[model samples]
Target: MSKEICFIADSSGGLPREILERHQIKEVPFYFKFQNTDYYCENVDYTGSEFYRHMEKNPEDVPQTAAPNVNDWLGALEERYVRGAKNFIVTTISSRLSSSFQTASLAKDVFAEQHDDVQVEVIDSNTCACGQASLEIAIAQMIESGKAFREIVDRVNQAVGSVTTLFVVNNLKYMEAGGRIGGATAFLGKLAQIKPVCEFIDGAVRPVKAVIGRKNSLKTMMDLAISRVSDWSRLIVTVQNAEFSEDADYAVDYLRKAASYSGKIYRSDLGVVVGAHSGPGAAGIGLVEASPLLR
Candidate 1:
């Protein structure tokens, strides 16, 4: 008999609430605090729009994210384990960016004795925000289609490599404030009206290049990302993040021109978890190749 399977991921997955519920996946929250009141990432208590607005009103008040604690995982997992899940797959943000992977892994070890049948597969998505969320959704689809545990894992691993994320920041102020860029680079970028193009390469967030203006930066990001893929016509999905109306529109208009994609394009907030790192006024595009099973 096949084992009963369930999907799990951290809040960094950044999936829309409805999609997450539709897939019946569980997400452990990452912590974020505002005005001395703490809230879990993705919790309705705090919305991306609200957080972004707060940042706008108080540019100096940069929020930080905390990894889920052992108890956070334990409490969440215990309820699910009781529901008869025999095997589990939990994916999280890059270890280089956060410690959620380690926390989840340790929690699995701690609960092994009581839930021996539960196999927790902790995946380091190696990308944050919607990029990580996109991977989780892909894996969830694989599981729901009745792929075996090992098969699903192998497919997810392959998908991870296939996944590529490229984004451009409207300004370097927030990143500079968060120390993502050096003082000199930040200063020069501000003076020159330079927009930074960033990508998750080799499991690390690095600035690939900078452009003189937003329009040029968008074109360059699209060109570079499209160049990496052999068949833009085969692209199946595109996800975007936007804080300002113009930034969102710019992403949509530019991405449409860059690739010949055939599948549905979805939009999601950058979310607080990712926003905490990427900051507001960030726009990005991620494309997932057509699944062999679907084809």
Candidate 2:
């Protein structure tokens, strides 16, 4: 029999459903409710387009997501275990951002007690949405290439630290709506058209810098990317958001002009799971590869 290692990820992994299905990866999606109709991310019950349309019609219908229960996680692992998957690696959003990491870790420890021979490694990722998903995809690719479990795990840890996401919101409306912006700053930002640059630092979203104009916001992000990147040729840029394709394109253009980009540029849907927090006009560029985190 061939060596079997399975990858299990939560909805926040940000990988497109088709790619996950193509690779046969297991996904335990989070829950969202719309107009009393329940939806699960990456589930057949609800789709990306449908979720966005629902949000458009009902902006007050803020979709909330909850982490999968321990049983839910155990069920996914057991299904793979029966199929001869002796080892499993589960990637989840950051513990600081969500309890999913904690939930997955507890499930791993509990499941390990029942099956001593099986090893389940849970990664916090210290990221959310596609940023978390990109790390999971990297692990899946390495496993598919026949890399050893230990080697894959080590590389994953390194990549987690290396991955960085920079978000530039078109307006502070969403942040204000989400109560992330304070009364003082929100008022000032709105009046001045000041775009705040937020990033995933360590495990949480923190305001790193601010720019006066959209152009500067884009430039600031690109400048940060260029400064952090060493070998530009190996860099892979993943741009994500529902309504900011133009911003994504502009970021890619800046990178092309400033650095070496050998890897392909992938644009992914920010989806409702993240849109709820970042808002509709938010655009972000996530830079990832096996390297050190740029300070």
Clashing residue pairs found in predicted model 1: none
Q: Tell me model 1's lDDT, rounded to 2 decimals.
A: 0.73
TM-score, cand. 1: 0.90
* lDDT per residue (tens digit) for residues 1-295 in model 2: 1257888888765676666876688888776675576656545577665666666677776667677778889999899898888888888888887788888888898889999899788988888765665666566667777877777777777778778777777767667766777878988998898988888889888888979998898889778867876665445566776565687788888877777564676667775556767666677777676332221
Q: How accurate locally, in lDDT, is each candidate? A: 0.73, 0.74
Residue 271 of model 2, lDDT score: 54
Q: Where in model 2 is the C-alpha error above 4 Å? A: 1-3, 34-39, 291-295
Q: Candidate 1: how large is its RMSD? A: 2.5
